[model samples]
Target chain A: MAVCCPLLQHEGERGEEARRFSLVLRAADELCPWVEPVALGSCTLPARGPSRFFGGEARLVDQLGAAVIGALDGAGPVQIGAADGLFAALLAARAGVIVPPGGSATFLSSWSLAVLRRPDLAVTLQRLGIHTLGQFAALPARHVLARFGGEAVLCHRVARAEVGELPGLRDPRIGHRLREVRGELPDVTPQAGFFGGTSAGDLRAAGAVARLQARLGPEAVLTGRLGEGRDPADRGRLVPWGSRPEGRHPGRAACRAPAPWPGRLPPPSPMVVLGDPLAAELVDRAGRPVRVGATGLLSDAPARLSIAGGPWRQVRGWAGPWPASERWWSGRRRRARLQVVDGGGEAVLLAAERGRWWLEGRYD
Target chain B: MFVSTDQGGRAKPDLPAELAARARPVSTAASRLLPLPDALAALFPDGALRRGSTTLVAGSPGGGTTTLALALLSTVSAAGGWCAAVGVADPGVVAAVELGLDLRRVVFVPRPAGAWADATGELLGAVEAVVVRPPGAARPVAARRLAARARERRTALVVLVDHAGGWPFGPDVSLTVRDAEWEGVGEGHGHLQGRLAAVAAAARHPAASPAVHRLWLPSSDGSVAASPVCPASPTRSATTAPATTA
Candidate 1:
């Protein structure tokens, strides 16, 4: 048996329109687990079980039409057909009729050679005045093979209602493609109870992240979290994804709740905060090194900034010197921050500690 | 002062609502396109990120490339779409949060080391979107294979580059932040506030002309919003931003 959902168009309908087509497959799948997607719009399965359960093929087709039409959302009419094989069933589907049991040969007899989809063979047969399957069937099997070659033998069998389907009729990639679009790509689909309520998107993400972690050490793949802190770096931490809070002392591996922290940089944190601060130099216009003194003030008005002894970039604007002190319980230490916009229109956060400066973040 | 003007396309802020909307696995794939925040929507020909397409967000080292790339992923993540960031090294989580991403839906392969391509390839079919930043100029053959794989899987692949040329192949959509103006900070007064980035978009469609628009990449409150100001010229000559008082 086969049903063609109107939603599947051959014009690359694999995108948005493909969803409804998948729905038709789902409805069919509910009736039987072995539903196979034959092509863009049509699918097939063993008709015996579903037909028997519904009392007869006609009754099953009626219920299947209702279910598939609902899935289509009125997109188009659903075509249902059942016969001995895929070839006859698809032809029966087009005619929107059920072939009686043992009636596939009678049903397929009147159809033209075009249904075989072999244009060259169909053209040759048409020129020979054997226009319909019945006429082609009337020819002797040995003569058909001797004249038309190997493929004609298969077509002759199909015309005689022997084979279930043609080679190109069923797209073997349909199931694989549908599962991929649903983010159900793992060879062995992990059961749902294992992950409560996470979307297929999330499951897909988890699978990919796991693969990357396996390839590049567990610590490489991470998830970001924000917590209470005074600077961008302290506020945002990337913990190895899936790390247990108990493994790193409860409440630390995961981000803590946001709390008021004094001297914190205000709204709009830097986009890229460096893990390893790059050494930088700042100087006054008179060619003198600029410093942040003990009073949390600049020793001189800075005019130029150079990163790691690179070419000097004229400073266009500046802000900060927000002093934050810590470790007073052990030993007192102080650090100050500054935001500067260079002449090239790039903004960077520069931090000074112990009279040394380094690039801390970039507002990219 | 930058005021946020919400776009019709911004995703729901609540995770529960997004989860509820996720029950229909088929509906998401129906669009063949991923949603983008309104501010960046006009950049693409379809006003959405087409699945299987590659978009390159390019700019200088400090020219808002990171911010724009994150902004591109924020709406999708907020909508409960799974997103992966490869080669970001150290991402500012607060910045990502403030930019509108639902952190729970985003995974970061901050350091892919030598297997960046492999990591990205593994993620293409599994996630709705994957953001990759190659450590250096990517090789043509490797880039070609990745692009082909992305197309085959129908995943939206966003490549972040220091400059457009860093990617060996031309992308389906190419967006570059030409320049930006800081609105709040002065020589020594106020604080670091919003930035109005002058961005240019050129999609591969032959019928559509390239476009330029100014956006508050990190508007006053940290979310990306549209700027009321006119776009700057393509010659990169003008900086027409008037610092609006917040």
Candidate 2:
């Protein structure tokens, strides 16, 4: 299967567009398991294997048509072109013709010059009155080649059905890995001033960490926490990589630490460790959702968050002024509060009104 | 190439007589063309899906429209074409896995706010096939843009319509899935057990009349399969006597 993006020229910023094209290719890879996409001009795979598997060329084309339809699933209409070469297939698909075998030359013979005039090449061909493939092909190969340079030579070959060698097959075994970090600091105060007050800093910190991790490779970052004493220590862990410490070991510190008051400080709340730290959000462009990352919300926040590549968006209606404070008895006490809302109207309250914002527990 | 003719020295074509006969000029009105499959089938037919054509698969909730869509994906993947499922509200990863699809080969794109149509259109330009599950609240214009994109990219699209309503693009094929019958199997002689039912659906193709097929869960394996439960020939009575309940 080959994906050809005709908007390569019309869309400004070619690099960004190409990256988006790659994302679509990746998306196609995920939607269909049987067919491996070979990145050609946009993306292509040899039809020979597929044809054989489907019984014959005709069957293969039918299967391809169905596959394309299945892939689109009504998001929009789609066109499919399958043929012997990259150019031929694209042309066939564009013309809405399922060209039969040995019809490449005939198809090229009738192809209009407009088809060859890409935005990048239209100006160069106008001077020659080269309006059709037949007209261009009629010229002496050497003369045409001399005037247009290598492009003319390549076009001449394509028109004559002497296209260049096919691109090599891509490694089908390509894979990826991710790393991440998460933590929960409860019993901390919420400052009413900031987004979520106390937890806001940690969330921002987690965002920064996620961004840093992304630089290492393509990954996503997520920030969320549970409510008051719910699974205390406010659990968080990176997936597909670093994992929580397992089994009691002398090398690893246990949850308990000696309290300064000999029985105070809430038994030294459990420590947050980076467990199986795997990163999320592996994508090129096109904003394609490659994988789902961590789903958690700050205390007094929404129940769930859908993190693709940016800040977490609240899942349900939840707005907060989550009131929280720490070191209440000491002169060093702190307070904070915050609110979080999603584009879908769901809001979460992370802090309550106080002289200052303070960190508070999460909702779910 | 040489030309041949009859004894009077008239040039005759080298092509076979039958071929020559077939090439004879004929009026369009005289031709009998095959009817187009319903919009849904047109989009993902067992044969070539005509470009520039739109197919709409519309059904109510729990009608198994999504299941049918996934089944099409399985067919496409098995045939070796890259495919994608975009904007799927429910990822349904387990179901896809159960169908024996290659997870790596499939890409799942989640777009919550209908903004996915634009990005999906751009993506469709490069991929072999793309499936977009528009949010339930998609507008008519959004649907049209998607259709336009499909035409521009020459991509085949299968739109899953969640509600029973008309689509912006008068699809070349329209399919509706409905429950046909329900049966319950008991764990023991007097114990009521799980319920199973068969679904009857119609595929209306463009240029062609509608055809009906029945989908039922296999008794042994519990997988859905479709067969021509209703006969097309006119030899038998259109209506048969209903089976009596015990």
Candidate 3:
């Protein structure tokens, strides 16, 4: 069971709002340890153990309400609701009612189906002549699963007050927002993975990642993935690490050698794939510029190369002008890729498009 | 040379520490060392990545340092150890797979900017290994702090630098990729098939001298393993970078 404190009038001045929120939280903390500040003007906490300590759920709610009202001192109306779950408790607080234990379903029986907050489902249920939550709850669970699918089954559970929490009911960033309101630096963290237990290394790594995210903004920490693409840059993707569930390991899928694709550069993938390819110049032995024609053939063998107009180096070994006309559907330009190794043993992959070459990556 | 120091304080004062270090069996030292692949073991004094030790990988741009550093994390990650990389900008995911890094075990803060030290410090004890490339020259204090934290945490730290002097703190093992030569390609013919990298190691041990090794950064099979010198190869130190394989 959970209890909710919904402040009807705590949002005028910035300082005053912070003051009221903290005071409400302080008062709530005196009664229980797991006080969660859900938003600027609302909070929730577990009621089972605290209810037992205060003799019953009603006494805890009354004591909590009195303490909160005392802290506010006629600042506004304080509606405290105690019920089986977050959804029921939030609505109960809005209605200013203390629903008796296991009577949440009975209390919610009178509410309109719109209170479920799934407007589409509400419209569909209403079309089926189910207007109130009680009417929706009376539908067979198996039939709900069959006709409405898993999400509607969840709504059906919430309609019965069986499960108090729904995925979209609570704001995910409430904690970060509240911290910012308190003039504290906020650390954003995603919800824990479905796995219930974690090892000590996981705990430490999660803490470090969260700290880095807070310090360096969210996008700095990243994990790499090589999806299906012919271009090396197209294949290598970096996603903001720790911003999603990590139970899906990145190993099994990434470790397998890339499945052969037509026009894919052969093995020994480049180590340095430039995010923005640098302009390069390739020329033949006669000091004539080399170009890849529409036939996907080089006009002349590249004998010298210069990247970004740097000093020209003797191309000791070279291969390929493999056609990779990727953007042709939108812009009718032809593109081809070439591999070159200089006398210094530096190997580079270059893409020739629009009669010019660009340094794509380095096989360092 | 991370022998089980259960024999540390005990009466081995006259037993010459070098002898003991060399004689210690692989089994006992393993608890303190992350296992190294057989191909790379010959380059390290302990034949493993020592716990709480800093290893420096220095080379010119495109001189195979990235491949070496990523290669170090492969076995450790395959063994289910967590590893982190900081300041390795624009890492190639396909290449990382080619280098055998289990992407799941590796975390990258590719560009930490001014907070690189803090990020590396925070991850030292947390992950089994941390490979970092400084965005700029590292300060003495920052370098010392990271090295000290790594030493105390039993974490393997691999620092990538463009030059030998780039890292201010002393390192346990310093591997510099002197040069590399691409193989299996001709003048405008075949594609890239392999690369032979010339690597040199300078460790802190008093008796060990700096040694140069020739190995394939990515061999014909697309894996890093030791190389046998090609008999007819010519050394090319005349133009672009440093001295090449003789």
Candidate 4:
């Protein structure tokens, strides 16, 4: 018969707790420099080589427990169990009991079949009055295979204390000695103040943002790229960092200097584009409001426009009312955009929609 | 302004008289001058971009502002130092190749909007040089604050101020492309081959006198080289022939 040693009372999952527990496991590696440790919190280690090295299975478990406790500053309730298979070893560790070699089957014979954690098999066995692993294992192997498949047969072997396939260890060097300590990590965010400062604080801030991204997803931390489009609002595309841009390859498309558009506002685009156009008043010579006709023509010659504040300035060099209409099927609306250079040499882009004039953006 | 007679692109051993006067022990984090390519040396006071200071490059769309920015970034990145660019709407990859910038060492954040300051500050903390543009019309106070942060981190900040409005706040040094004339393109005679531009630079204190140079903003060879000044013109001119390094 082979041996399996299982640990109990694993650490919690918070970052600090996980780090502290990793430290304890690392220390375990130092003590049993050859046994590979498998994880569940309380780690499970194969006891063959380590047992031989430490005189016997009993001494090996005792030594590992002592070493782990010592490394943890004597944190108590370090349970270690050694048995023939993983299932029995885990149960034994939980109960702080060890089954002697060749007596694992006898020890497991009285435990409930539910100990295997196979709910369906346990329920079926219960319905059939087979309440314990001993009773379940006592059934004909052929009959168990025919009914529950190879998985059930493997369970049957584990219940009988016969060594089955082992799980891949989480840490390959679980029982291997750690050669050196990784140098102390610098403070994630150095206390560089708001302007320019230490990188530690910036690094820490980036780390925090990464954590938040992990929780909330990549969409929350957006990195935008300028794309080719006529409307200022549609010109920029916000995408998660590292993701490929949607639609056309906007990057290469806009590489060369674009052809000058007659109606487009020239270079020095607005610093900020208003999400929603603000209502304004466009007036004619007589102080009456200027209106647009249904045919996309101005009701009167537009002479002046006012936005946000100040006295209305006379429009000097004026451009077209490039009319645009969208969502015709849902709820059609028409908007006309005009580029107006005021008498003060200042320029602004204004849009008129639904018989109302609004300031779209500034050319400053 | 002092002038250099070395016309060829080859590196000159002797420093220009003007730069030699301005060359003093710079208080740098590495305690050494941050090197600039020899071609652009005429544009700076000490023949190097001083660390922990801000340099503003402003020009119209066709005025070679991007070329200048990539040129500055290339110098630092080629020397095995990391550099970053924020709010440069154009992808620097295509232009970096033309400017001889090492793409592998340079990091480009194409469009940093509202978080421009934060992003630039972070890059200043880590990279040797950072090139950025104001996401919006940055107030003078905000611009000064960003410049102060760069000083603290010992990282050089290069701002690509728009040619139309220029820099929101005064920079330690400013380079403006006064005018650019395209070459080879005649009515319908030839393709838009390259450009020649007059660049003017002025530094704060001591070097307040503006220095002007006419050069190939991007010569036909896709490299920025010093062009000789027109002999008939009174303005300071480099050699009419492109400066050849070979």
Best of the candidates, lDDT: 1
Winner on TM-score between 2 and 4 is 4
lDDT (Cα, tens digit) per residue for candidate 4, span B170-211: 677889875665443221122233446778888885855788
Top candidate, metric TM-score: 3
Clashing pairs in 3: none
What TM-score did chain B of candidate 3 earn? 0.80
Q: Per-prediction DockQ, in order? A: 0.30, 0.01, 0.39, 0.06
Q: What are the fnat scores of the candidates, in the order listed?
A: 0.78, 0.00, 0.75, 0.00
Off by over 4 Å in 1: A1-196, A246-257, A329-331, B1-27, B232-246
After superposing candidate 3 on the true structure, give the runs of residues whose Cα lies further than 4 Å from its correct spot: A1-199, A245-251, A255-257, A285-289, A327-334, B1-30, B230-246
Q: Write model 3 residue lDDT over A21-52, tens digit each, in one string.
A: 66677788998889887656778888788888
Docking category for candidate 3?
acceptable
Best by DockQ: 3
List runs of model 4 lying over 4 Å from the truth: A1-364, B1-29, B186-192, B229-246
C-alpha lDDT of all candidate models, in order: 0.78, 0.40, 0.75, 0.59
Interface RMSD of 2: 21.2
Rank by DockQ (best first): 3, 1, 4, 2
TM-score of each: 0.61, 0.32, 0.68, 0.43
Scored by TM against the true chain B, the candidates give 0.84, 0.61, 0.80, 0.79
DockQ of 3: 0.39
Residue B89 lDDT (model 3): 85
What order do candidates take by lDDT, descending?
1, 3, 4, 2
Cα displacement (Å) at residue A356, model 4: 34
